[model samples]
Target: MDPINKEGTPKTPTVIFDADKGKVEIRGRSIPENSIEFYKPLVDWLDRYADEAKGNTEVNIQLEYFNTSSSKCILDVFKKLEAVHKKEGREVVINWYYEEDDEDMLEAGEDYQSILKIPFKMIEIQE
Candidate 1:
């Protein structure tokens, strides 16, 4: 399947979903006016990717900030990944990168880790 490569604007994040490489990445701020609309294609791509998924899928999420609406959409994306791991029995690893001084981002990663069954690696990066 073709990958989704979206450039980040002030209101959105850069998204890179490459099924061939079994890698997905989202970086930058996510505060789109319509979160669902902005994230729908990615969700759909995941649905299709589940059919022909790789042995191991790596997800890298590096976000500086996200609004309330984007949070739910982010969770939805994770849920899709969870299904790939659980129902499909595919290996999925999430790398949640947060700046060293960003407590909120670290906590957000923790919260998602607590909620999702997939393994998450909390990576602390220099600001």
Candidate 2:
């Protein structure tokens, strides 16, 4: 499957979904006007990737800030990955990165970890 490479804009995040490497990265702010529309293709890509997923898929999410709508879309993305990990029995690892002083972002990652069954690595980066 072709990689999903989207440049990050002020209103959206940069998405790099590399099927060959079995790695997906989403970085930057996600406050798009239409969150669902912005994330539909990504969700679809994950669905397709599920079928041909490799041994372990790594998802790195480093978002500085995101709106409420984007939060739900992010959850949807996680759910898709969760299915790929559970039903397909493929190992899915999520590396959730946040700035060193951002408590909210850290809590958000914890929340996602609680909601999903996949393994999560909380990474703290210096600003």
Best by lDDT: 2
Model 2 residue 92 distance off true place after TM-score fit, in angstroms: 0.7
Residue-wise lDDT of candidate 1 within 1-127, one digit each (tens)? 9999999999999999999899999999999889999999999999998887967899999999999999999999999999898855589999999999899999999999999999999999986
- Name the 10 consecutive residues with the lowest summed lDDT in model 1: 82-91
C-alpha RMSD between model 1 and the true structure: 1.1
Q: lDDT (0-100) at residue 4 of candidate 2?
A: 94
Q: Which stretches of candidate 1 lie over 4 Å from their true place?
A: 87-89
- Total clashing residue pairs per candidate? 0, 0
Q: Judge candidate 2 against the unseen true structure and give its global Cα lDDT, from 0 to 1.
A: 0.94
| True lDDT of residue 14, candidate 2 | 97
